[model samples]
Target: MHVFLPDGKQLDLPEHATALDAARAIGPRLAQDALAATANGVLTDLVTPLPEGAEISLITKKNPGQAQSVFRHSLAHTMSQAVGEYYGRKGFPKEAVKRGVGPSIENGFYQDFDLPEPLREEDLPDIEAIMREIIGRNLDITRADVGKAAALEQFSYDPYKVELISELPEGEPITFYTQGEYVDLCRGPHFPSTGKLPTAFKLTSTSGAYWRGNEKNPILQRIYGVAFASQKELDEYLERLEEAKKRDHRKLGREMELFTIDPLVGKGLPLWLPNGTVLREELTRFLREQQFQRGYQGVITPNIGNLELYKVSGHYQNYSDSNFSPITVDDEQYMLKPMNCPHHVRIYAAKPRSYRDLPVRLAEFGTVYRYEQSGELNGLTRVRGFTQDDAHIFCRPDQLKTEFLNVLDLTVLVLKTFGMNDVRFRVGTRDEGGDKYVGSDENWTAAEAQIIEAVSEVGLPYSIEPGDAAFYGPKLDFVVRDVIGREWQLGTIQVDYNLPERFDISYTGEDGQEHRPVMIHRAPFGSLERFVGILIEHYGGDFPLWLAPRQIAIIPIADRHNPYAEELRAELHAAGLRAEVDDSSNRMNAKVRQAELSKIPVMLIVGDKEQEERAVSVRERTPEGHKERKGVGFDDLKAELLERYQTRA
Candidate 1:
């Protein structure tokens, strides 16, 4: 059989030879380093027989996808064996520790087990020691295919494995990988042997998981671990984990008193405290001004609309699972708006439009609700109720690309304003043969092409993702990397022909005939709640002067200087700044510490000298330390604060 290499070189090999045999034929070094292989873009294990005339690319430590998955999967198998061995040594039979599925996920792997005795966090070290010992044995790992009857008999004692094997389609090969006495039923692309697996792994934690993520299914203990190619990488990841813990928005939000989730209010519904509300208002004002300057007219819509509106938009059919149940009002059903576009569409359909109103942009800071699962809800990033800085542009077909580019520019500006400089784009197009999409083929093709062309014209780095588009249209999502190197999807712009067609909305063209108007759906800040959550983590709870809820805290040295502190705060408030006076009878040093802990950006100290000079002593927070500039005139201080607020410095 002839097989092609990645470099276009062809070689003849035995008919049923595996990828490892192909690697050996190419070079000994490649065979030794090979972790997995990709044949015609499908990842496969080296032990799998290569197809005739296939295109093969050997995956080593250099490749991100297959190498990581292969090694991590192998580590999971090793960990499972270690667990069984540990139980066996403790007088329990090895068979008593039944293993469930173990799969390689991003950055690590996890395995589910049904053991006679439950595992605890304290047992992780002993398991690690056993894993290391198994690795030292350098046990050979091999795969084998078995028929249904043979597989069922082999795994009859393990109910999880039996259930999995029973569900396998007929005529499909059942495969299992074995290392020493530990065997797992998996269709795997795993490393050749235990010795080849990296030891730079640490079992992180244990949690309960249903066998197949179903609540009705039996619960299993899941052990989570992270593996890296080298010790240095592991160390770096651990350090980042520590930093992430400190920057967790949920923890920081409570400490800063920004937002809270109350049991009475229900899960996934966040109540913004006064401080968080200020942050929200400032962001809304900034975006509203930007939209106004760009010729967008603001609009308001009710929080609940008739169910028929969503039915026309196809959101009801596609997103009902994630949407709250309909409300029965006078025997007619209404739904809490899951999106703003449907309501905005009705506004466009309210009156007949003309070609001269070709690009009608309607903007809203609209709040919408969704029935997010409890497990998926985080502090504010994933919420039941949130606001979107949403807008929809109705334009002539000829203006599609231009309108898209304008939205793209606005999105870039929003990201930069938030100091999210590291940005990437993804153009989500429909799957070619998928039935889930609602629009016609021609409309899908045209909308996707326009998005790609607009992104190309902007000269932004982007990749195409199939099957990631919304049912109604293709979309361009802006993913930004935060300060801690975590990526979040913050902004999106989508083009739609389906909604306009479904609603039969049109404008009178110059030729005196009606024409369908294409719709461009965009949200620079996808959700105000999510955006604030990410911002909190991005800034590590230390916001910029303009965005800070409490921009300044004035501290008086003694009760005698309280009047001056109050006066300073009044001046700051008059300057359109959020300021507070520390009149709680606390010492100046304690006041400063409190301000620092609250992440207040600036602190002004007032004393007798400053009171006489009619100035304040400014102490500003910096990366290095508190910077103190003494005897700054009150006028100068106000001007500086105004400058930072205006320029967003």
Candidate 2:
């Protein structure tokens, strides 16, 4: 048989030979170094038989991404073996532990097992030691296909495996792999021997999971582990993990008293506290003013809509799984609105538009709901109900590019104002030959080309990602890297040509004929709850002066000066600053400590000399230690502080 190399050279091999044979024909060293093979982009084991005229490329450690995935997959099997070994030494039978699927995940791998006893966090170290020993023994890894009846007999002890084999498609091969006294049902592209595997892996934690993700199945214990090609990468990842714990939004939200989820209210429903409300309102107010300046009219929509409304937009078909179930009032099915675009579409169709009103921009801070699983819900980032800084533009067909660029500029402005400097764009195009999307071919093509053209015109780097677009359109999504070097998907702009056609909306053209107007959907911050969560972590809870919920604290040195402290608070309040007086029985030091702990931007100290001189002692919080300016004139301090806060970071 003949096979083609990556450079388009042909290699002749014996008929029905494997990829390893092709590698050996190329060079002896390649065969020795080849851990896996990619034939025409299909990743497979070195021993897998190659098809004639296949495009073959050897995957070694030099192929970082593919090699790491293969290694991680094998590591899951190794961990499963170690678990069985550890249990055997504890006087349990070999069949006492049954294994479920073991798959490679982002940054790591996990294995699900049904064991005789529940595993504790402390048991991981000993099991991990057993894994090391298994690797040291240098066991050869081999794969083979077996008949369905034979495979069922071999895995009779594991009902999970039995069910898996029974579910395989007819006429499909059932494959399995083996190591020293340990065999598993797997289709693998693994290292030739355990000795070739890297030891830079650690089992981090354990949790309970169902056989699959379904709640009706028996619970299995899942062990999570992370691996990398080198120890340096592993160490860096561990450091980032530790820092992430310190900057966790959940912890900070509770400590800072920003937002809370009350069980009585419901899970995944966050109730913004007074402090959190101020932070949320500031963001909304800023976006609203920006929209107003950009010629956007504000609008409000109902929280629930008729089921037929969503059915028309096709969101009912695409999002029904994640969306809340409909409620029946007077035998009518009313759905909690899952998207703001459908409502905005109705608004555009409400009034007859002309070509002169080419671009009708409508904006809203609309709250929407989705039925997220309890397990998937996090603090604020993943919630059941949240508000989006959403807007839609109905423009003439010829104005699509201009409207898309305008929305892109507004999104960039929002990110830049938040100090998110490291932002990149990803253009999400439709997946080829996919049926999940709804749109005509010509519309999809035009929409995607316009988005790409607009992004390219901006002269910023962007990547084209297939299967990332919405059901109705192609989108440009902003990925922002935070201070901790973690990326978050923040702002997005989508050009949609399907919604207008579905809703049958149109505007009169210059030719005195009606024409369909294209729709541009944008949200600077994807959602208020999620954006605040990312912002909290990005800033590490030390918000800038302008965004600070409590901008200033006024502390009295003694109870006798309480009256004067109240006067300062009133003055700051009248100046449009959020200020409070610390007139409680706490000492001066306690008062200052309390203010600093709250992350207040400024603290004014009232003393006898300051009161007599009509001045005040000022202390400001900065990234560094406190900056103090003593005995400043109260009038001067107010002017300087107001200017500083107004300047904003």
Candidate 3:
């Protein structure tokens, strides 16, 4: 049989030969270094037989994906064996504990266990000692298949594994891996031995999780651990974790007295504090001004509407479970609006009839509610009552491409203004096996084609996500990576063919006939609250000059300089800048420190020397220090700060 290498070179080999065997044929050195292989771009164990005409590439320790998976999987087994030995040393039988599944996740691995008693936090160090001892033993690892009956007998003491064995489909292979006295049911291309694991692995934390993710099933104790291919990588990951914790939005929000979430009130309902409300309003006004410049008319609607409204829009049929239950009126049922699309559709359908009025864009910063599960609710990412920066464009069929391109331009503006340069897009398409979306296939094709063309014409970096579209139509989403490299979905633009049909929307055509106007749904910021939450963390509570709740903080070196500080504050306020004077009875150093902690973008220190000269000493927060000062005329300072504020970032 023939196979192709990554470089497009073809090689003849024995039919059904294993990847390891193919590696040996390539070169003795390659076979020695090959940890795994990717057959036709799909990662697989080296023991798996390669098919004819497949593209195979050997994976080594330098391959991040292969190296991390191999090390994390091995760490799980090592931790499991460590736990068993720890219990044995405490005079407990090995059979007293049963194991659940452990697998490599995105950043690490976790093993679940069914124990007689919950493992305490203090038990982790002892287990680590045992894991180190096992690593020092350097036991060789091997893999083999076993019969279902034999697997069940070997794991009889572990009901979890026995259950797993019983659930195996007929004629399916059950694989196992053994190292030292530990054996686990795993399909793996593990490292050659225990010594191959990085010495930098560490157990992170423990949590309770339901078996098989079913809440009704037995709760198992889960231990999470992280492993890296090198000590430098491990140290970097640990440092990032610490930085993430320090900049966690929930923690900073509290410290800055911004927002609060009370369990007694509700799980996902966040109450904005006075300071947070100021921030939210600033963002709303900012977007509102931009929308006005881009030809969007503001509109308002009620928070709750009749149930039939959503049913007609197809949201109630598909997303009913995620919404709040219908409110029982005296003789009818009404539902709290879970989305603004249905309401926006009603507005469009009200008194519309001309092609000249085509491409009508209506926008709203409307707040919607959802019933998010308690466990899924994070700070602002997942919330019940949050506002969306939503808008809908009603345009002629021929105008679809232009409208989509316009929306894309607006989304890019939002990203660039916030200094988020690493923005990528995803085009979501319909799933063939899923519902056909109760619209004509012709309409679906037209909408999908328009989206593809518009995105392609923009010449931006993007990918396609199959089966990720809305039920009504295909869409494109914008995602941005934060400072620590976590991707967040920030904006979306969707083309809908079903909504116009459902709402019976039509406009008079130039040929004197009624024609359906294609609808484009867009949210540039997704949500002001959520975006600000991400921004708070992304900037570490140090907002840009314009977006800061207090743009400038004026500090007076002595009580005598308070008048000069207040005078400067009044001038900035008159110029439409959010400026404040520090009137606190504290030392000059303390006042400056407080302003820095508050993250006021620009600080002006007024002493007798500066006050007499009608000037201010400026200190801007850069990644460098603040001791470096620049003196400028008060008028010049105001002009420069205003320019930065208007341009943002």
Candidate 4:
């Protein structure tokens, strides 16, 4: 058979040839340096048989993207060997530690094990030492393919591996890798030898994970590690990870009294306290005004809908796995709403429309529910229930770009208003030859092209992502980087042509005939709960004055001045500011410290010196700590503070 190199050079070899053979045929120097090879854009082990007419590129350490994964996977095997040795030194047999699967993930690799005893944080160092020793031994990594009977016998001591082997279909290749005294069942694509691996790895932590992510499966301990090309890169990532720990929203949420997830209330449902509610209200009002300016009318929707509604919208058919099981009521099935688009569609179809109503905009802060796995639930980012700032625009085909651009403009404004300036979009189109999506190819292609043209005209960078689109049509998703250099997928705009057809909704055209209106589903804040959680971490709990739940904390030095503080509070409240007076028995300094801890944006302290002139001393929180402005007149201060917050400064 003949194979091709990257530059289209052909090489003839015998039947059942491997990449290693092709490398040697090309040159002895290339063969010696090759760790692995990329066959038709997929990285593969050199020992794997290369197909006829395959385009291949031998990979060395120079290939950053492909080589890192190769060595990282090799490290997983080496780490497993060290784990067994560690257990051996502890006087435990190899069977005491049952191994599951391990794979190279982003920035790291991990292996799951069913251990006789749980591993502790202090034991990680010992594991690392054994791994380094194994790598230093310069053991060769070799592979072999075996028949099912032999493979089953080889791993029969381990039920996990046996179960895996039994599940493989007939005629599938079973391969195993060996280095020194350790051997394990795994598919190929590893480094040439253990010594060739980089030492830039750390076993970060360990947690319990189900064998295959099913709650019903046996729980295995999953050890996580981070790997990089160099120690410098690993060090930088570790530092960022430490910073991220400080900015964790769950920790800050409790400290700042933002929200809580009570087990009794449910796993993913968050109960917002007063301060947190204020945050949501402020964000809602900000976007509400923006929508009002763009002629969007707000509407309400039910939390649950008839099962038939989702069937017509294709949500049930295409996304039933993520949706909760239907509720049977009087022989009628209803489901917790998985999306707000179907409800918005009914609203548009409820009334008659003409060419003047070509673009009917319906918006809602609609709460929707999904059946998220318990293991998949995070603070607010991944939840079972959340509210969406959803809006659906039904416009004429000719007005598609204009209306999309209008929504895009509003989305940009919304993100910018909260200091999300660094942003990019992704055009998620349907996967070709896939049964998961709805709509015809012609319509799918048109929607995808319209999205591309729209984002391109706006001159924002975007990348095409196949299989990331909505089940109904193509979409454009926005990803913004936060202060700590973490990128988040916040908002999305989808151009859907399938839902309207399935629902049979239309508008009268200028030609005096009923015409289908192209529907654009948009959510500027994809999930309000998630958006707030990101904001909490982005600002590190130091919210801007306008967005701060408690904008001001008023303190009086003496009880005699409590009445004055109350007066100041009422006055600020009337001016639409969230203000509270610290009338607790705690001393004035303690009260001021408490305000700082609560992360209030402003503090006003009144006493005999200031009360004599009906004034207050102000302390404002800034990026560089709090600044004090003494003896400011009440009228002047009130006016200045209100203007600054009103302007969202």
Candidate 5:
């Protein structure tokens, strides 16, 4: 059989020869450095037999993207071996510790073990030390395929492994990897030897996870660790983790009094505090104005709708798992609307239109409900109920590209407004030969083509993702990277022919005959709740002046200057600035500190001398540095703030 390399070199090898054999054939150094390989673009273990006439690339520590996974997964196995050794030293029988599945994840790897006793956080250091010792032993790792009967017999004492083997399909190969005294059931392409594995790894923590992720199954101690090819990369990642902890939205939300969730109000439902509401309202107002200028007419819809509406939209069939049960009332059924598209569809269907009205753009700040499981719920990112900045545009086929481009413009404007400049696009199209999507193949092709063309015309950096499309249509998602280099899917614009046809909505075209209109579904802010959560974390809860809930804090030097502070606050409010006076009986410095803790954008200090001068001491919070401009006229200060607020500076 012949295998190819990226340089177009071909090598002939015997049948059943693996990537390791090919690497050895290429050169001794190549074989020694090879950690894994890819056969025809699919990552493969070095021990796995390469397909005939396949293209293979030998992965080494230098290949960060692919090498990281192989290294991390191999580390997981080593960690398991270390755990068993640790337990053995503690006087437990080798067979007493049952091992479950372990796999490599983003930035790290983890393994699950059903231990005789629960593992504590303190055990991680010892486990990590054992892993280092195992690596130092230079153990030769090898993979082998075994018969199911023999594999099950070998793991008879471990029910977790037995259950896994039992669930394998008939005739599937059962594979295992061995390193010295530790043997694990895994299909792996490990390094040539343990000595080749990088030493830049640390066992971070341990947590409880159910066997196979099923609640009814036995709980196992899952140990997590992060690894990298170089210590520098690992250190950088660890630093990012520390910064992420400090910027965690949930913690910042409590300190900033942005939002809250209570068990009594139901899980995953966030109650927006006054400060949080101000943020929400400001964002809404900004987008509302943008939409109004873009020819979007706002509409209001009910929280719940007739059950049949979703069925017609095909959401009920596709998203039933994420939807709450129907509410039956007097022989009729209703449900909390999980999407606003269906409601907007009804709105379009309510009236007939001619070619002049081909493009009917309807926008709404629609709140939706989905049945998210308790475990999946986070602060606000994963919630049962949230509001979408949704809109649907029904236009003629010829206008599809133009409408999509317009939606893309709005999405870009919205993202840039929040200073999210590092953006990428993903054009999600249906998978070929898949039954999951709706609409005719011709319609799907046309809709997908329009999206691709629009994205190309806009010259946006994008990649096409198969099987990431909505069930009803293809979409373009705007993925924004925040300040800390975390990516968030913030906005989406989908081109749909399914919903309009499913609802049988039509408009008169130039031919004077009724024709099905193409629908475009767009949500610049995907969801207000999730967007705000990302924003809070992105800015580290210190929002920009335009988005700050309390734009200015007026601190009085003493109680005697209360009237002057109030007068300044009124003037600031009159100029459309959000300002408040610190009326509490506290020292001026304390008041300033409290205001700073609240993350107010600007602080105005009032004193007897300032009142006599009819000027306020302005302390403006700039990203570069905080500055104090003394003896500034109140009117001048108000003008500058109003200018910043208007320009969104």
Candidate 6:
């Protein structure tokens, strides 16, 4: 058989010749340095048998792709071996440990073990020592194929592995890798030997995970570790993780008194405090105003609906697990609305329309509910109930591109108003072979093409994501980056052709005939609840002047100046600014400190001298820290505050 190299060279070999064999045929030096090979673009172990007429490239430790996963996966096995040796030395018999699956993940790898006793933090160093010893032994990593029955018999003592093997379909290849005596059922590619394990790996943490991600499954102790090709990359990743920990929104929210999630109230439901609500309402109002100017008519929809609505929308069949189950009464079933499109469709059909009214844009801050697993819930980022700043536009087929452009513009304006730049678009479309999506190919193709053209016309950078589209149609999701370099999908604009056809929605055209109207679904702030959560982390809870619940807190120097502070506070409030006086007996410095910690954008000081001059001292929270004291006229300060508020600075 003939195999082709990436450089277009052809090599003739036997049917079962391995990549390592092919590399040796090419050159002795190539064979010496080859750690593995990329066969037809798929990574392969050095001992993996090559298919006839395959394209192959010999890969060394210097290659980063498969080498990383292979190295980390081997490290996991090595770590497991070390763990067993360490526990055995501590008088725990080798048979006392029952191992689960150990696999490499994005940044590192982890192994689940059913240990005789739970592991302690103090055991990590001992485990690491054993792992290093194994690495020093330079144990050869080899693979062996066994029949299903033989594999099951070999792993019968480990029930988890037995279960895994039993579930594999008949006639499927069964393979295992062995580094010395520690053999695990896994598919290749692995490093050449244990000696190839990078010195930059570290055992990070231990947690409990279900045997196979099912809550009802047995919980196994999971040990996590991170590995990289070099110490520099490992150090950089650790630093980024530390920075993310400090900027975690949940901690910042509590310190700022923004929002709270109570387990007693049930997991995944967030209660927005008064200040957090103010932030939400301000965002809503800002988007509403911007949307109104761009021809969006604000509307409201019910939070629950008859089950039939979702059935017609096809969400009932496709997303049953994510949504709340039905509530039945007198043979009628209702579901907590998980989306707003069906409700908006009824509104569109309420009145007869002509071609002049083809593009009917309806907007709403609609609340939605979904069942998020308890284990997956985090502070506001993942919640069961949240409000979506949703809108649906019904337009003619030819008008799809223009309507999409308009939605894109609105999304950009809304993002920019919150100081959220660095935005990109993801054009999500249907998978060619997927049965999960709705609509005819012609309509799907048209909708997807419209989005691509719109994005090009708008001159925005975007990526085409197959199978990432809505179940009903193609979409453009606007993603933004936060301060810590984390990316989030904030705004979205979708071109939907399935819903109108499903609901039989239509409008009278200029020719006085019925025609189907294309629909564009858009949400600038995907959800107020989630948007604020990202904002909390993005700004570190330091809201902008306009959005700050308490934009200015006036602190009196002493009790004698309380009346003056009250007068200044009332004056500021009368000027339509959010202001408060710190009337507590706490010291002025304490008040300033508390305000700063709460992330109030500005603090106004009222001293005897300032009162005498009919002025107030200002301290603004600058990126570098609090600004220097500057005294300005009370009215002058109000004017600047109003200017900033109006411009949303």
Off by over 4 Å in 2: 4-10, 16-19, 22-31, 41-43, 59-66, 624-626
The TM-score of predicted model 6 comes to 0.94
lDDT per model vs. reference = 0.91, 0.90, 0.85, 0.90, 0.90, 0.87
CA displacement after TM-score superposition, residue 414 of candidate 5 (Å): 0.7
**Cα-based lDDT at residue 234, candidate 1:** 87
Q: What are the runs in model 3 whose C-alpha is more than 4 Å off?
A: 1-16, 25-28, 62-67, 120-129, 147-168, 214-219, 435-441, 627-632
Could you give candidate 3's per-residue lDDT for residues 1-649 as a string of tens digits? 8888999998788887877787888998887777777888777656767888999988875664556776788888899989888878888898987999999877788999988678987778778888999989988777888998889899988889988999999779999999988899988867767875778877888988888877678889999988887778788988888888888999989877789999888888889997788788878888888889989999998889899999999888888668899988988899988889999999988896799998899999898988876556789878988899999999998888988898899889888887788988998987787773668778878878888888888788778887888888889999998887777998999999889999899999999999988999999899877897898888888777777777788999888999999999999999999889998999988988898888877889988889878899998886465644656789998898888878764
Ranking by lDDT: 1, 5, 4, 2, 6, 3
TM-scores of all candidate predictions against the true structure: 0.96, 0.94, 0.91, 0.94, 0.97, 0.94
Per-residue lDDT of model 4, residues 1-649, tens digit only = 9999989999899998989999899889888778899888888888888988999889876654467778888888888898999999999998888899999988889999998899997899999999999999989899899999999998888999999999999999999899999889999688878887889899899999999888899999988888887899899989989988988999988898889999999999989988899899999998999899999999999999999999889899888778999989999999999999999999989988898977889999999998888988999888999999999999999999999999899889889988999898888987767778887888998999999999899898999999999888989999999987889999999999999999999988878899989999999999999999999988998999999988999999989999999999999999888899999999999999999988998999999988899899999899898799999998888898899888888
Count residue pairs with overlapping backbones in model 1.
0
Candidate 3 lands at a TM-score of 0.91
Weakest ten-residue segment in model 4 by summed lDDT: 60-69
Worst 10-residue lDDT window for candidate 1 reads 60-69
Off by over 4 Å in 6: 63-66
Which scores better on TM-score, 2 or 5?
A: 5
Q: What is the C-alpha lDDT profile of model 2 across 194-301, one tens digit per residue?
A: 877889899999988888887779889999999988888899999988988988989988988899999999999999999999999989988988898989999999
lDDT of 4 at 68: 77
Q: What is the model-wide C-alpha lDDT for candidate 2? A: 0.90
| Model 4 lDDT, full chain set | 0.90
Instruction: Give the runs in model 4 whose Cα sits over 4 Å from its true position.
Output: 1-34, 50-59, 62-66, 557-561, 585-589
Score residue 27 of candidate 4 by CA lDDT. 88
* Model 6: residue 111 alpha-carbon error in angstroms: 2.6
Better of 1 and 3 by TM-score: 1
Q: Residue-wise lDDT of candidate 1 within 20-120, one digit each (tens)? A: 99999999998988878888888888899988999999887565344777789899999999999999999998679988889988789999999999999
